[model samples]
Target: MGVTLKDVAAAAGVSRSTASRALSGSALIAAETRALVEDAARRLGYRPNRAASALRSRQSHLIGLVVGNLVNASFHTIAEVVQRRAAAEDYQMMLSITDADPRREEGILRTLGEHGVDGVILIGTGSNAAASNALLSGGTAVVNLIRGAAESAAPTVLASDRDGAGDATRHLLELGHRRIGYIGGPPGTNSGDERFAGYEQAWRDHGLPLDERLIERGPFEPSFGSDATGRLLARVPEMTALFAANHEAVFGVLPALVAAGVRVPDDLSLVCYEDISWLRWWQPPVTVVDNGARELGELAMDLLLQQLERGRGSVPQARNGRTYRVGAQLVQRESSARPRDV
Candidate 1:
């Protein structure tokens, strides 16, 4: 016969009940005893009968992670961190991509709920207000990640994007770049709006006019960067610097800048709204506003787990409502410099 719980307990020199408590992650069991039982289970190749365990616990031991776009660098890191955190608690994570499509997000939310996910962690603005409200009041634990107060009704964790963007934009202004071109995601998304607010706030604080002619708004597509940058530069020839709202757009902006004969920190200084590793190695390393995506993911999942552990209203909230804001910082690199006189 294959190794069973009894066999594992016998090997660990502990009573069956003690071994069971250890294996079940009961804190009442001593740490040494838990380690010993885990070691025995590993050596004996003892696998718990999940079906029976599920019947006893009434939990699927599964979590659903929903993201607007999988290809986005930010979501990729977030998903990785979520999976790792979920697994540590003996919970498995299931991923769903909505492509930021409202209808698709709506359908997927229903699907995940119907499939009996113990909890959900969603990124970006939810699909529809009705659906979001339904799920928020549906009594299932849900933690919204990466969205701001305007989009979230339940517990949420978000990057301090407005502050990050404001800081980066201010840096460009400080470098004496009078004409700064801005490229970002469409206006509907709370994230995009907040970032734009940061850019606007910086100009307001510095008593500078934000030239509407230099701003480009589009979908969060890599292609958008090139298309918009080309158009912006062609129209506003005096524009000396560019700011992109997300990492994917940076890829698009670079090729367009190259084609236009613009040299980083020479002919045209540049800064990115989002930071990723490869940017550091670019010929003139890019300056960026880096909000720790991985940390955000970890903190978000931890909040969801807390909700699951104690049910709704267990997680703490601020005076106004439920929101956790992760901070961001500006990374200065060679990509930014004072504008050269046209």
Candidate 2:
């Protein structure tokens, strides 16, 4: 049987009331008495029941972490950080996955509220604002990760897509590649739109005409990337380079290139976002835009704790909303080279 408070009290020769105070750090006990209780707890290997403690305090100290699309390695990296951060602060996590759908996010939030999570940390784009509003209405603190545009005034932490995309575009432009193609993420996702806008802005800044025929949008699936790549190649046969929005999208594009017998870097060079573990280990090392995902998660949890302590009283600066933008950097690799003719 597990050691209990009664065992600890008995071993310490102290009253139950005194033992509880010593263990919970609630009331201040004498130094001698506290020492005795600590010694007894250590000797007896006493473990306090967290559920019981939560019930007595009416505070779970548990954050509901609802993530969308765990298939994306970056999200998993963020989750690892969140779990560690929550534990460091003497809190727990109630995790959920919504798989990139707004309706599912609504259901997950409702379930988390019913189960009594202290706060919620959402990691995705385009969740139900009504559902999040409902969570706040019930006095639950919320934070968003990897989401730039949101309806709620709640704090959000997003990857810096605009500048990262522009950097990628500039790299290609400097390589003397005039015909560049882009494959973007889902339409409603803020990151997708911002990245697409950045791509366009880079072209304009370089005095290069925007080619509507070279752009395509789809789900961030490998198959969609392959299809988009094939379509872009057909429409703009002279295009010498491609910029895909993500690693998964690149997965699709690479296979399509292989099937068509298109030589990489020689026929077409590629720059993509995200470098998964296996990616760098593969044949041609892929050049990519790597945002600090673990840092993003840690910052989001920090913001959630801050918002919870603040209790919606103060308005955050910048667009009159609570939001955070995590910066990203481009990783150059062997997959991209100077244009064939150059």
Candidate 3:
């Protein structure tokens, strides 16, 4: 017969309940007893059935983490931090990638729900309110990361996109770049809107006329970045600096600049939003406004832990949806400089 708790208890010379408590690391059991029970179980090759224990305790000890995609460096940091934090707390993390598609997000949420995850941390697509709320209404703790869904009541953790973009714009402005071009993300996204607003605010702060012709808004794809760069260069040939607010777009921006025979800082200075490792190694390096991805991930885990503590299967009371913002900082590098003419 397979080794069981009863066999372990006999070997440890204790009652079955004592063996169970000791193996489960219950603090109520004495240190010495726990050691004895652990030793006995190891010697007898007895393993506790986690599924049976979860059934008894009503906690799956699992957390679900959903992200738009792993391509963004910020998402990569968030996944690493959340996974480590969940492990430290004895919770298994289940990760899902949704490509920012609402339908995919809905399906992932439903699957996580079926798995009975105790809580979820996700970069919401801002269009999956129904799926998210259904989980929350059923007592599953949910914490939104990065983008947020307005209709969902879940707490959110985000980087200060407005402040970060403003910093990038101001940096270019300070460097004597009068005609600065901006490449940014799509309109409806929270980060995209806030970043664009910050750019406009910076121009207003500097008393400069906001030139609408120098701005391009599109997807985070390299093709969009290349196309936007072409349009800006063609439309505003005198543009002295470019703030590539979309990180993914920077990839396309650099290649397009090269193809156009534009030299960094000499002909055109550049500043990008969000820091990734490769930015520091690029020829001449790249200046960036760093949105604190690591800090955002850590804070998201903290918020989810708070929700988990409120008890499983209990809905949170109605209150103003709370958002926690991580600070952003500008990391200066070789890519930005005073315009040659200035």
* lDDT values, one for every candidate: 0.82, 0.80, 0.89
Q: Candidate 3, which segments miss by more than 4 Å at Cα? A: 1-7, 10-13, 40-47, 259-261, 312-318
List TM-score per model, in order: 0.85, 0.87, 0.92
Clash counts for all predictions: 0, 0, 0
Candidate with more favorable, higher TM-score: 2 or 3: 3
Worst 10 residues of 1 by lDDT: 312-321
Tens digits of per-residue lDDT for model 1 on 1-342? 878899999999999989989999899999999999999999999999876777687677888888887657888899889889899888899999887787888898888767667788888554454454455465457777886445446677888988998999999999989898899878877668888999999999999888999898888778988899999888998888888875567778988888888889898889997678888999899999998898899888888888787755422233323788889999999999988773
Cα RMSD for candidates in order:
3.5, 3.1, 2.2
Supply candidate 2's per-residue lDDT for 198: 83
The most accurate candidate by TM-score is: 3
Q: Can you write out model 3's per-residue Cα lDDT over 159-204, one digit (the tens) per residue?
A: 8999999999999999899999999989999888999999999999
Pairs of residues at least 3 apart in sequence or in different chains that clash in candidate 1: none
Ranking under lDDT, best-scoring first?
Answer: 3, 1, 2
Please, what's the RMSD in Å of model 3? 2.2
Residue 138 displacement (Å), model 3: 1.4
Instruction: Kindly list the per-residue Cα lDDT of model 2 for residues 242-330, writing each as its tens digit.
Output: 99975557778878888888777788888887657766765577778887788788898888888667653333334424677888898
Candidate 2 residues lying further than 4 Å off, grouped into runs, are 1-4, 25-47, 311-320
TM-score of 2: 0.87
